[model samples]
Target chain A: MEYVVQTTNLSKRFGKESAVIGLDMKIRKGEIYGFLGPNGAGKTTTIRMLLGLMKASSGTIQIFEKDLNKEKINILKRVGSLVENPSYYPHLTAYENLEALRKILGVPKTRIHEVLEIVRLTEVANKKVKGFSLGMKQRLGIAASLLNSPELLILDEPTNGLDPSGIIEIRNLIKQLPAETGMTILISSHLLTEIDQMATTVGIVTKGKMIYQDSIESLRMYAQQKVLLKVSDSEQAWRSLLGNGIKADWEDGIILLSEHSDGKVAKAIHTLVHEGYSIYRVEEEKRSLEDIFLQMTTREKVI
Target chain B: MIGKLLRADFLKIKRKGLWFLSFLGPFGVIALQMVNYGVRKDYLLNQSDDDWGYFLEYVHSFTPLALVLGIAILTSFMASIENETNAWKQLISLPVSKMSVYLSKFMVLGSLLFVSSLLLGVFSLGYGILLNLGDQIPYLELLKYSFYPYLAALPILALQLWIASVSQNQGIPITTGVLGVIFAYSAFILPDWMIWKWPSLMNEWDEPLINVMLGIGVGTLLYIVGMLDFTRRDVK
Candidate 1:
């Protein structure tokens, strides 16, 4: 895979406490990589290290296959980032704010208007940012990140403090970038649902460590629903199902079936009916991604 | 890159009142003299055989204090512009090197102080002509007095920028600046090695040129140290 961003054993320490420890992040080209963690999970710290805003205590970061320490300026040329809070000069107008960065990026003045229109701030382009709402400021930050037409964009909590509609707008925007422009994105958020909706690749971190890194589908596999059977004489039914080579678990007077395919569930039901057990109820119980995310982060176990 | 950064920085400070402060520092220094000459024109004129020299001396006395306080406020204001929004992280993330960012800030502040000094020279000469402090205008002396304090104050400018850039709290630099104004006010009693005393252009050798040379050399050294320190740390 052609990775847009890769890190090896990245770590950062402030005095005796480690903020980020042994993080190996791989962000592939043209994929929205979701960096998911709870608050204070060192998401911002790792993003800072990636952007060269903060030095890593120990590790190597390679962007575009070049060493970050030696080629930071060159690497950053193709990368755009918005870390932590949205950074802006409230005194400057929205156009002026992007113009300030556009000057540094050396992009055309027309590019500024394009990004403003992308963020839907064209009407307020001439107004000072101090009076802007949180969502407007966030859109401005996103607009600034896109000013360079970067190949790789990193945003920390991009939807933070936005209303539901605004969140959906940003989420759709992020989802479209990889397809529309072939841009690789690394978006960090504390909400698992947000990541679930946007990221193709997911990396879960908690307390300075990455516990889960894989495709979003694999993470969802952990959240797959299971078949639950409630029947009279459940103990006998469980043994009977076990003797038939079905993997099952009996807990609290209920039979739990992990292999919950339609054929397996139908066969189990048929077998239970044949064994003369009265089937009272059969239902599927779902494990949401939030549960899996909470378990992974709180347990600090690699999956 | 430095040029672009400078242009962007100049744009950032447009409504910040920095330009007014730059113009005001020199005008206030000359305005103090206006009040002095306005009150006792005849009495002050009788005190010195070199009337123009005496007027320039009185003007020079307040120059160091005004320069020191001005440097404090201006440098702090420049730093707060970035620190206000925590824009350092965003700025450092740019393709430009952190060294260039520091250099741009130093250059901007340096340019502002230079303009203020130029205005002081002009204002002093205009008021001197109005006072009729003799036909021998002492143009060289006027130039020396107006520009020397600014040159001698370079080290203080560099030191304040260093402190203001690194400090998260504006109060720290402001407090240091207050102490600096005190030192400049009592310049005669201060030791020669003090950065604050350099602005007064005083030393045991009694050569204003010595202070100018020390300001340039030490100012450059302090600037390098500050830039190195700024680039070494994390943006937050």
Candidate 2:
């Protein structure tokens, strides 16, 4: 697979504190690679290093197959980014704000209007950004990022502080970019649900370490529901089910079954009851994606 | 790329009253003379045989202080325009090199000061003509007095910009500027080598051109040093 962005052991240290350590991120072309991490997980630091805004203490960053150190300007020509807060002149109108960047990008002036339209800021194009709500300012940031028609777009918490409708608007816009224009996007957010909704591939970082990096579907697999049984002599019941070729695990006082299909569950219960074990209760343990995400981030371990 | 960045920077500073400040700096210097001549026209006219020369001296007296304070405010304002929105990260992230960004800022501030110098020359000429100082206007001396301080003040401009750009707090640059103004005010006693003293165009050797030469040379040196530091540091 062709990768649009690849970093090898990228690390950054401030004094004795290491912000990002040994991060190998591979983002394929035309994929929405969600950079997931909680607050203070070095997401902004990593993105800054990639954009050449901040220097890495050690390691290499290659964007569009070009060494970031040597070809930063050339690489950044095709890369657009909005880091942390939405940066703007605030005193300038929305149209003027994008126009400022448009001048640097050397794109046609009409491109400004096009990006404004895409972010749905065309109507308020002449309004000063100081009066804009957080959502509007964020949309303007997105508009500025799209000014150059970049092939790779990096946005750190783009939907932050936006209302629900605004969040959906940005989410849909990000989701469509890859399909419509073949642009590769790397969006970082602390919310797992946000990444789960948009990212095709996910790289989860916690405390500056990449613990989980895979497809969103594979991440969802970790959230698969299981069957938990409360039974008298649960240890013996679990062993009895296992001996009968019904695979299950016993933890604390509960019998946990990974394969929780209706037939498999019924068979396990029948075996436990037939073995003279009285079942107190049988319950389906549903693991939400949020729970799995918290476990992965808090445990700080690769799954 | 530098041209484009300059254009973008100019666009960003719109409605920020930077143009007004540029116009005001020189106009304020001349206005001080207006009051000085207005209150005691007869008394001042008898002070020198060359009336226009005498008037130019009065104008030159305030030029250094105004130039230093103006550099401080202008450079600070220029930096705050970007710092206000934390746009430094966004700007550095653009395709343009960081060196070019620093150069563009220096050029913008330089252009503003250049315009202020030009206006100072015009305002002094207009007032000298209105006062009927003399048929022999001593245009060269008027030009020298109006523009010499600006040229000699370049080092301060460069230093102020350096401080303002690197400092996260505007107060640091403003405080430095206040100290510079005080030094400019006491230029008679200050040693000739000081950057703030250079703006007064005063030296023990009694040659104004030397200060201008030193200003250009030291200004270029300070600019390079500031640009190097600016490009080396991380944006955040």
Candidate 3:
């Protein structure tokens, strides 16, 4: 299937308030699609709908090229997911916890060892999950979702509770998923940097509306790149650049011109020196994924 | 699917005190008589011509209350296990239907209650032998006293299980369970149609089999209603 998940005008309302409205999501096969949204931006609600855990008020969901409502069991069999925080039987051993799910999944018994090994919990497999740390629990949750060897893995905030290094590890693991196995992943997160490194395609949502959905390259194009000019004559450089039809602003005794092309930069420099401006240093300021994400989600339209 | 779910549910509650509670219900019912016989055997023995009948009547008195309370606890415990682990979403997202999930829970509760009812039979007979109430033990009456209350308590079991399964706050089911226990305690005043009264076999008709039939029929109906409600709604 070209798209692992497709939805049109999906909406979910709780009484008078709408949790998610008019959401159109398209997630392609073999791509790590980042479902980006701020906290309470209806990320979890959308994921729940795709998994059939919650029924949509009005919408259609197709997964694995099959209608979700019609082929729920068959479609779900190839989809593995971990929603929000990982839920586990605290009293049961880690191995036993997966064993419980494995029985329900009707997978092979050895699948328990495989998942435990994949998440690197082999040594502690027999230990009760009550003692596991947050990162370990998240990993175990990932392990549980992979027990069926699903083709599409949907994880909601998988790294929500992890530390910086644990976050990096999970990000790398997600990045390696497509090469290791031809599986598509839909990972939802509020952290733009987390998604930037892990996702091939990004969907930015705010207040139940998707502000932007495209490839990472297209999302990066929205970022506002600038050239920082540290010149002795900051005022002269600003005026000269403005006269050249380039918008220039002064910040901390420097002139910043927005995304002037290489040719324009040379011309702007030539004009600066012609205006008797002493250029001490020039630095290119690349807009971060965080900047682009904030601009797209917070503004009325993606700027 | 139901069988697999039942096995999984059983494994989840392996060391969680539910099994001990199941044993306690039957053992407690028999232990109360142990004290009665130890203290005043003569008074209890002189009441009826048939010693077995008198002992059975006394045993039956405690069975209804214990069975009703046990149903409440078992159903609540089963639901709480899933709630505490937050396993409902994971279970429903599997390649199984929600109806199977409901049936699995009911079957697990039904199986545990069955075991407890069987234990009641064993404990009641062992104690009756120990009392030397009589060599002529009315095996049929003893059997009825042990299992009849279980069968007749089905409607209450189904009702409590339904309440427990859908309720997010355990207190709601517990409250309903407490009211059921109180009503079962006063079954003498309750109407025949009341599920609580069916367990006590206290109806105007005075036929135990009629109550059993009603329990099974009404119990099945409630189970279907609860299952339909559960399958139609989103799992929280």
Candidate 4:
């Protein structure tokens, strides 16, 4: 139940546009919390508030059990962040670019090489950042965030410009961070599928509102798997299911039952057969995370 | 901690051509003098009974002009380096306070200008020796000409740094800088209260030290005001 970060009623307004409205975020220790939302859904804004880069128009933020506004310096000592674009001096080599930040953060010189190795940029560390591809810049940004060995790392679109293999590499690296170093990660992205495999908990935001926040397993349940059965007599099978206290909906000629569990599917199949109906095929339709995300956000139900 | 911050600030200025301009400012001033004195030594020397005094005046006149323009370009370049790379967000999000970040920038710019002033002294002294302007080196006059303009130009430096730091578009800062240079060029017509006119060392009281004193007092005030303004706003 220990939380590393907690926000209550955090909001930001740009003139009349409510960029982030009354957001309540909770991130526990050692959890890879996926802040899932579409573009302009206030993911970047919320992260900025947490990092003390931007002030919240209203409400309070607590980091490491200290008020973020009152104890920003002390709180930031244990936190590292990469917000919006990964900024680096293009004229400087990758090593020098990181070296500049290292001097400010006061980390050891050897730590620079360690972070370079962590981001797999050691070979090209001597090259100037101006010549780097977008993916390289993104990786260097992540490497800069790790220079301090912070307890909490907030990454805004950490895998933004990476190729497929680069994405997988960063994903695995992020996945191992908690186990290897006991660091809590909050990575924001507009793509749900990207966070599907890595996130233990998720907060889905849409149009400045958090529609859902819970374990990833619970989010999967939102997809609502449906078991479609082809039966000899569909109406009679539906009637039998209704009488047996099973929820069944008829769509086209097939009997559709929600697959909450395998036991539920078995009971529905048994009841149809007990009513003397021959079943031909029982097909299960499983929805992906993308489908669930689209459904939840489109519905815009406040959780 | 400030030392570490300064070290990092130095790394950022690498290959930015600010250092080259620092050397160029003094070198250019002396080079101009070389051409002037070389072509008309008799006319220039005859104008003043004191040969050293005349040479010092000529060298000092351009000192204020160069110092003023250097302040403008140097401040704009410093801020542009950060803006170009979007380093403000990265730097501000660090454990350091915004106040220190402002101070670090001011210190770096101040140090660069200080070096340019030192170079101006060395180059002018070397060129005057080549011209054989006087048997007396006029060491005290040389020191005044080397540093007085720098001290008097402080207000402009502080103001330019403020504008450059706050402005997102370099055009805004650069435009103000060009206006400052023009004001420096027409310092005689500008009112005595004008901050840009302070660097020109022209006064009815015949006290060059008055402008230097005003520059220090006003410059410190402007720097404090600028730092507070910078700290009060959110980093872009």
Residue-pair clashes per candidate: 0, 0, 0, 0
Q: Positional deviation of B8 in candidate 2, in angstroms?
A: 0.8
* Poorest stretch of ten by lDDT in candidate 1 chain A: A294-303
**Which lDDT tens digits does candidate 2 get at residues B31-77?**
99999999999999999898988998899999998889999999998
**Where is model 2 more than 4 Å wrong at Cα?**
A229-256, A271-283
Q: Which stretches of candidate 4 lie over 4 Å from their true place?
A: A228-256, A260-270, A273-286
Model 4 lDDT, residue B130, Cα: 85
What is candidate 4's lDDT per residue for A37-85, written digit by digit as tens? 9998899989988988888999899989899989998888788888878
| lDDT values, one for every candidate | 0.93, 0.92, 0.88, 0.89
Q: Candidate 3, clashing residue pairs?
A: none
lDDT at residue A20 of model 4 (Cα atoms):
90
What's the CA error at residue B117 for candidate 4, in Å? 1.0
Residue B180 of model 2: what lDDT? 97
Instruction: State the local distance difference test value for candidate 1.
Output: 0.93
Predicted candidate 2 versus true structure: per-residue lDDT over A218-299, tens digit per residue: 9888788989999998887888888899888889999999998899999998888788988988999888989988888988
TM-score of chain B of each: 0.98, 0.98, 0.98, 0.97
Across B1-236, the per-residue lDDT of candidate 3 in tens digits comes to 78888889889887788899999999999999888877999998888888888888888898999999999899898888888868888888888899998999998889899999999999989999988877887888878888888888888888888888888899999999999999999999988888999988767988998888888899999999998988888877
| Candidate 2 vs. true structure, TM-score | 0.95
Question: In terms of DockQ, which candidate is stronger, 2 or 4?
Answer: 2
